[model samples]
Target chain A: MAKQDRAIRTRQTILEAAAVVFERQGYQAATITEILKVAGVTKGALYFHFESKEELALGVFDAQEPPEQVPPQPLKLQELVDTGLWFIHRLRTNLLTRAGVRLSMDQQAHTLDRRGPFLRWREMLLSLLDQARENGELLPHVDTSESADLIMGAFTGIQMVSQTLSDYADLEERYISMQRHVLPSLAVPSVLAALDLSPGRTERITAELAAVQD
Target chain B: MAKQDRAIRTRQTILEAAAVVFERQGYQAATITEILKVAGVTKGALYFHFESKEELALGVFDAQEPPEQVPPQPLKLQELVDTGLWFIHRLRTNLLTRAGVRLSMDQQAHTLDRRGPFLRWREMLLSLLDQARENGELLPHVDTSESADLIMGAFTGIQMVSQTLSDYADLEERYISMQRHVLPSLAVPSVLAALDLSPGRTERITAELAAVQD
Candidate 1:
């Protein structure tokens, strides 16, 4: 068990190192030797976990799993907003998330499944929207799947613009603005009125989650 | 004048060659030598037109100038929709535009000004929105700059998604859907009702433009 724990730690260290390199230099330009230098690990140790750079990129991409715990909310629509807000916050601060998104967008760089993250995000949003629909939150004309597609596409676009314009410093504000513009078309009038789609909601939610974890 | 025309043709040939290579391999992996080979031009000829690969990328970016001529419209809102529709048609058939957008999104690949195309697009949209406002086509609360940002961001996102999902086969449809969703918020109800945001609008506009040019 102790040996297994140590192996896990080493693997995590390697993944983080690769994420930093991939995020900085992109997949085609990043080298295993650079990752080794950043990780402070022997080539043997690095190869023991990830056989190739593609595997390392996949590892980084997979690291961006949806948060394991979501604080319960009174309304599913609020939860949806929280989900986006929380991700914007994470995308701003988390190198892994940023690298994952960057790799996914760099479709010509690798043979790995570039669409995985997008599909996963779509599924997650669809599930949430399904719940919102069940809760009578969606407009009568709203199609959850289409809305999920629009939300994912719009979010990806906004993030790209933010990255180009401000390196994501303005991500929270832009994401909130996006939600403000888009949600009115998706949610019923009453639900849209009740939902809190404000900037800094992610920070407050993060604090709440941290307090709960404590 | 003959010498100038030859120079112009040579430059266009190199730009097309570079666009093809960049579209295939992206910015980092694409090589000037490969571009020269494809263009069937001497290195001196290529250098006479573009100094370096970065300059070549910028040249491709600059090639995406808005159409010089727009058919006059009674409503600026219709003109705005026609602008996007015309772009969708060009983006479908134009390799230079494709290469420009690809390179712009490949943030780490080159030192070229990646934001030039986006900022230009935003400016063009802002001007159109300003015209729409002057014509009283916009909502009372509509901010032209913000609406321009939203339109640009949303269009980028929808295009990316369409590229990923269908290799742009459905781009026209997706772009039309995006405008349908977004324009209602910016335009007044009467104008929105009057606007034709249909999927086949691009083909019709293309035919009309060709007829006018002829």
Candidate 2:
């Protein structure tokens, strides 16, 4: 049991180090030598975990989705908002999330299939929007799949622009503005009125999640 | 004049070949050797025109913005729509624009500055929105800069998503949906009623521009 735990820990350590290098140097510019050096792991051990750089990038791309779900809200629209806000918060605080998103959105990373994350995000958002429609939170004209696509695409672009401009320092602010603009198009006015789209809400939710985890 | 014309043609040939390779293999993976082979040009000739692969990619990136204007509209909101639709049309028809946009949005292309395209698009949109506001086309609650940012980012994301999903086969449809959702937030009812956000508009504008050029 102890040996198994050690192997798992080592894998996590290597993944983390790979994320840092990939984030800094991008996919093509990043080298396994740098990742190995940063990870401080022997060739045999690193190879045991990941076969190649493509596999490492795929690993990092898979980790963008948070392990824990946000606490549910009465309004499905609010749940969607929470999900987006939580991601923005993680993007600001976690290197793993940032790196995963970077790799997923990197059009130049030709070897690895980057579409998985985008399709997964669309599925998650579509499910939430379907629930919102059932709960009568959405505008009558809203289509769940289309809304999902817009939200996913808009979030991807907004975060990208923020990263380019301020390295994500203004990501939360940009996200808030995005929600204010897009929510009206997706949700009814009454539903929009009750939802919290503030930057402080991200902090509060992060605190709550930490408390629960503890 | 004949010598200058030949030189210009050679330069254009090199740029077009570079764009094809860059579009297919991306910036990092593309090579000058491959570009030269494709261009049927000697190394000396290629070097004479461009200093390096980086400069080649920049040249491609700079060519994304069309050299000609879309011909002004009476309502600037219509002008904004036309600009976007025209870009969507070009992204479909022009390999140079595709390669340029691929480089500009390639987050993995770490050497070249990618912000120029995004910022330029934002500046263009903001200028048009300012005009729309002056024409009483925008809603009173709309902030032009925020609207510009949202429009630019959303367009970026929408096209990217389309590119990933269908290789831009459904881009015009997705772009029309985006304008539908976003325009309501920016334009007043009277203005929104008059603007053309249809896929057909792109074809009509292209035809008009071709006739004008001829």
Candidate 3:
């Protein structure tokens, strides 16, 4: 049992080291030797745990899988978007996992083959979108597949821009406002009316946010 | 004058070589020696043109500055969005610059300091957004600054995804569909009514697109 625990601990150490090295040097530039050195593991130990660099990278990528799609609640389409946007905002701003989002957009995170993780997120999102649309939650005219692509695409793009210009962290507010405009058009009048999107709603969320002060 | 022209041509040749090197091997990985070799210029010529490797990278980045934004003919908000989405579609399909958008998003673009030629675009877009808001083209509640950032962020996002997944190149249609949802709430009813986004309109555009093969 002690030996098994030690082996598990070593695996975690290697993954942590790999994430840092990948973030710092990017995928193409990083070397296994350096990753091994940082992890304080012997080359034999790393090879035992992961046969190749691709295997290690895939492991790291798997660790940062995107959060599950937010389950639908009875709200305006705009509110759904706002709540999703808010979820990402919190994820990106959280001190414990700010680097989490970077793993998706920053080239530093491009060290691994992205087809797997990216596609998984895409699949999950597409399913959620179809579910939302079928539930009559989507406006009659809004195409959920395309909307999913746009939302995910823009999310990645906005995040990429933030990576390039750190000053654009507040770019999320822009997304929120855009959602307010766009979501209303797709939402039935009833859903649109249900959303309390005034400045007071912002105040309430702000207070809720503040309650979780670091 | 003749000697100066020759020198200018030589300088441009060196910069072009630098771009090729940076794009292929990335910024830190591509060396000055490789650039010189590609330029077929001596070290002295390279030094004369660009003082150092960093300066050479800046030269390459400056070359990427999009041709100045043409003051597009005044159009409705939907039309304005169509113009923007069409640009992204063209970037995806255009043979001359198909890969160029991909280069813009990559890490090498950040080689020479943070702000590159793309900074000019933000200011230009901000002005457009201000104009749209002033003309009552957007919802009264919309913040122009946030709205502009939203459009810009989404543009970057769509382009990023399209580059990686060729299946996403159909973004133009989806972009139009997306605008359909986004615009009605934002634009005045008259402005919204004037825009043609019918299914027939899409078939017509597709026909026109087919004519421009290559």
- Tens-digit per-residue lDDT, B87-174, candidate 3: 5545555422333344456554345464553455455556766777777776677666665566666666766666556545556665
Q: State the lDDT at A30 in candidate 1.
A: 85
- Which sections of candidate 3 miss by over 4 Å? A1-7, A69-72, A75-112, A171-175, A193-214, B1-11, B69-71, B76-104, B108-111, B167-181, B193-214
lDDT of 3 at B145: 62
Q: Compared with the true structure, what per-residue lDDT tens digits does model 2 show for residues A1-214?
A: 6999999989998999999998777777788899999999999999999999988987887778733479888998888888888888887778788899988877766667788888889899899999999999988998788878888888888877888877888878777887778887888889989999877898888888889889
Where model 1 places Cα greater than 4 Å from the true spot, the runs are B68-70
For each model in turn, which proportion of the native inter-chain contacts is also found? 0.46, 0.52, 0.64
Candidate topping DockQ = 1
TM-score of chain B of each: 0.94, 0.93, 0.68
Error of 2 at A187 (Å): 1.4
Q: Highest lDDT: which candidate? A: 2
Q: Tell how far residue A15 is off in model 2, in angstroms.
A: 1.2
Each candidate: what lDDT?
0.82, 0.84, 0.62
Q: What is candidate 1's lDDT per residue for A25-134, written digit by digit as tens?
A: 77777899999999999999999999999899889888665564668787887887788777777787778888888888875765666777777888888999999999
Model 2, backbone clash pairs (residues 3+ apart or across chains), number: 0
In model 2, residue pairs whose N, Cα or C atoms come closer than 3 Å (at least 3 residues apart or on different chains), thus clashing, are none
